[model samples]
Target chain A: MRLVQGNEAVVLGALAGGCNFYAGYPITPATEIMEQMARVLPARGGVFIQMEDELAALGAVIGAAWGGMRAMTATSGPGFSLMQEHIGYAAMTQTPCVIVDSQRVGPSTGQPTMPAQGDVMQARWGSHGDRPAIVVTASSVKDAYQMTQLSFEWADTYRLPVIVLLDAVLSHMRENVELPPAPPPFSRTLSPDVDVEKPFGNHPFVPFAETTRTIVTGLAHDETGATRGTVGHASEKIIRDAFNRLNHDYAAITQYREYRLEDAAWAVVSYGITARAARAAVDILRGEGMRVGLLELISLWPFPEPTVQSLARQVQGILMPELNLGQLILPLRAAVEGICPVAGLGRADGELFTPEEIANAMTSHSTHAERRVSHHA
Target chain B: MPKMGEDLHQYLRQQMMPTVWCPGCGHGNIARAIATALEHLGTDLGQVAILGGIGCSGRTPFYFNTNAMHTTHGRVLAFATGLKLANPRLTVITAMGDGDALAIGAGHFIHAARRNIDLTVILYNNSIYGMTGGQQAPTTPFNFRSTTSPFGNIEPTFDTVDLALAAGATYVARTTTFDFAEMPEYILGAIRHPGFAVVEILSQCPTYFGRLNKLGDPPDMLEYERNHTIVADEESVISRDELLGNLPVGVFRQEIRPEYTHQYADLCQARGGAYRA
Candidate 1:
């Protein structure tokens, strides 16, 4: 175990997980990831390229992936925004890659160095088309390492872009992280001879076990890679099957951690750095003889909805404290479906939520009962 | 150029054609020229990767039998950079239009030239956006009419050869469909040149640029190119032709440099890393 910053841990994990190619442009809170990658990649038989911008960064990552390298890029909010088009292209062409968005407060660079969970929705809907995204949030330095490696595994497995969301604070904070023993269970090492994957085949984009005439494009093309232009049969199948592939296997992709929730009357749902406070709050509430527990979300998209639904049936209410003005709560409420009251505690002041702050909210909600306000509509 | 006749079918994807280029379009001529160039090189066709941006030129990838990727507009060079570095053995080529290379993707273009990566870039300079129904392009002649520039374009044209040379391209050439017979010599030189190589083919968009500027029919445009252009044997494209309002057509720059991918492999080796690329 070594004490490493969140960004440093990401590089350690990505390299350990066999990311052979990295392309990036510097942005605040995420520059360390790129800087470290450049320093270490070349020395370790990996390639690191400093691209012109975030658009070219992700573009190069996709190109490298097709060139049979496990590729990735690091960015914050503004850079993440620039990568949306390529994200859609990766989806359309079914390229396997990882994009780590160390999010900061932003409409356009609102608070460059401050942490904000404002990108929660954009991570899912940033691209133009209807495509499913696998987003995993990191609550600590170690989680950052695990989630970054896990993003690569799931990207290769699902044949789509997997985004790992880390906030400014979590990205910089250091911790004694014990690297996962033996790389995330499913991490893949591509062979040297693999040039391209058969994009439309049953086993898609997995380091070309067989050369299948790689003709990848962002356009809606048939199996032979000819442009269909209209959303005809090929486009129709692509769009229609986009969600089903991930949703049906939701159990496998969705990963989370539950803390002290058995026989609890209330549950606080939070993720990333906010979960640290929520965990302390749950401990504080339980010490005061209140049955409150914490459900720390690790994966943001392909959300653990069934688990949230089961918690709703078990608890009287759910209180969610977030770093933004309530983004993930939309899907949480959809999962809860009015089974219980769901309230939100949002902080966008570029500060972490204190344990007392979240504990008091849960205490007040448990007593007032009439103060139940959930965006059920 | 060895018989671009029925034998050239080995280099093409027969089913995807009839190309999306218009009737009497010069993009097809350039595509055939590239095929003959690849055919002449006689390398394993599977080892080549043809990439294109979003335009009439972008569709060229679908017609090649090699490993192909149709990338985003103006960003194919950036993609090719990563691709070539990833697998240095793969001979990479990118085809882009004026708007794709100069207007939107200008940054990537100069940087690719600056790095001098081992990739052959073909610019089908049609002077208008043919796929998007003829908008004013960066290569569009000064005050030449286009659909977007209905009142006649006031913007100055980007001299394709000068731009390539200034941007540090080691091997740069400008040819037109009118000079089709000589096109393969420059293309073959580009493919073998061991660094960033650019061949800017002044292709005809008879359907768009021809119509907007009243440049007569496709044959008339090709004939016009033959009449107006001078064979460039001088140090600079503008040395003698600038006075005649004529563009130069020939291989203008050919120099040697350490290709990006080769240097990357050397770096990996020097660092005692396991990278064999």
Candidate 2:
């Protein structure tokens, strides 16, 4: 175990995951990732480029991904917004890459040094069009390191950009993390063969192979990678298939942790740094003998629908503690609307939700803590 | 230069016939010259990737039977930079248009040249956004009438060759579709250059630029090119600096600069790593 910041852990983890190309533009809470990449990437026999802007950063990352390299970029809120264009492009082209957003407060560069989870919804739907999104949130330095590597695996396996969402609080926090002793989890980046001929049965996915002349475009394209102009007919189906390809394994792809939630009446649904407080808040509620629990969601997109719905049946109410103005609550409410009453405990004051604050919010917002579980059908 | 013996038409996607471009658009001539240039250089099509932006010129990649990427508007150079760095052996040919390169993607254009990365960039200077119905491009000459500029364009034009040279491109040249026989040579020279190489082709847009500006048919547009542009030769003293909105068709700059990817490879080697970017 060694002491490392969440941002430093992300750099170490991405390199371990066989990331060969890194293109990034500096932003606070994420610049360390770029600086470390620039320092060590060349020595490790990889490419590190500081692009003109966040738009070009993601663009170059997508291009390197097409070249069959495990490429990535790191940025904060403003940079993430700039990246939405190429994020949409990466989705349309079905190129695999990893993007780490060490999120800070923002409608637009809201508070550079402060922490806020305002980009939770943006990560899922920032880019225009109905594109596929795989977003995973890291709650600690360990989670940040582990998920950064897992992000690469998921990006390649799903053939889409995997966003590892981090907030300013977690990014700056230091912790003792035990990194893997081996070359790390993602060993596949070395082979650099996506095998589109057998797997995707498409040429557009492979950029360098000679046997299949690849053609990648952002427009709605037919199976031949030719532009179909309109988004209807065969090309529409192609786009649809590409967009929801990861949904088939939604349950598997979407992950969450149950913190003493096996037996509870009221629960808190939270993720990232807020989830840390929620976990502590759950322990506080249990001490008060309130029969409350915590459900820490890891994968924000491909949301754990079945798990959240199952929890709603067992619990009478759920309090969603978030750093934003209740972004994830919309999905949480939809999951448990008819079964139970759900409330949002939001804090976007560029600070984290304390344990006592979360506990107080849960109890005050709880709709009749004594309500029977029999209220559910 | 004894012409390369083998026929390069094998690299053309003959199966994908009926190009999307309208009739009399000079884009087709420039594309043919590119194919001929590839043939002249004996570049293996399999190892070549034709990357393009969103415009009439952007569609050039789909016609080539090589590895191609049709990217977003004005972002072809950004993609090409990454693609070339990822696979240093693969020759990346960037195809972009006037508005795509000089307007929306102008930042990437200068930066790619500033890096001096190895790329064969073909800028199709049509002076109009034909794909979007002939809006005025950055290269549109003064007093020109476009769909967007109904009366007359009062804005000055961009000298593409000068911009390229100023951006630190190792090889900068300009040609015209009217100079059809000699156009391939410029493209061939760009392909052979080891660093950032740019070839701006003054392609005519008869469909829009011709119709709106009363430049007549495609033949008349060719005549305009023959009358307006000066060909650079040993006797010529005019520099691209004094373009004054008129086209200058010739090689403008060629220098010995350290190519980005190759320098990176040397860095990796010095660091004792086997991989070369």
Write one digit per residue (lDDT tens) for candidate 1, span A164-185. 9999998899998777543321
- Candidate 2 regions exceeding 4 Å error are A182-205, A228-231, A367-377, B1-8, B233-235, B239-245
Candidate 2 lDDT: 0.84
Candidate 2 chain A lowest-lDDT run of ten: A196-205
Q: Residues B1-277, candidate 2: write the lDDT tens digits.
A: 4353257568688755678888999999988888888887776787899999999999999889888899999998888988888888888999999999999999999999999999999999989999999899888888889988898899988888879888999999888899887678888888889999999998889999999999999999999998788876334687666645456678888888999998888888887655564
**Tens-digit lDDT track for model 2 on A206-296?**
5466565878888777666766455456556765676566767786788888898878988899999888989999889899988899999
| TM-score for candidate 1, residues paired by index | 0.94
Candidate 1's clash total is 0
DockQ of each: 0.64, 0.71
Error of 2 at A137 (Å): 0.4
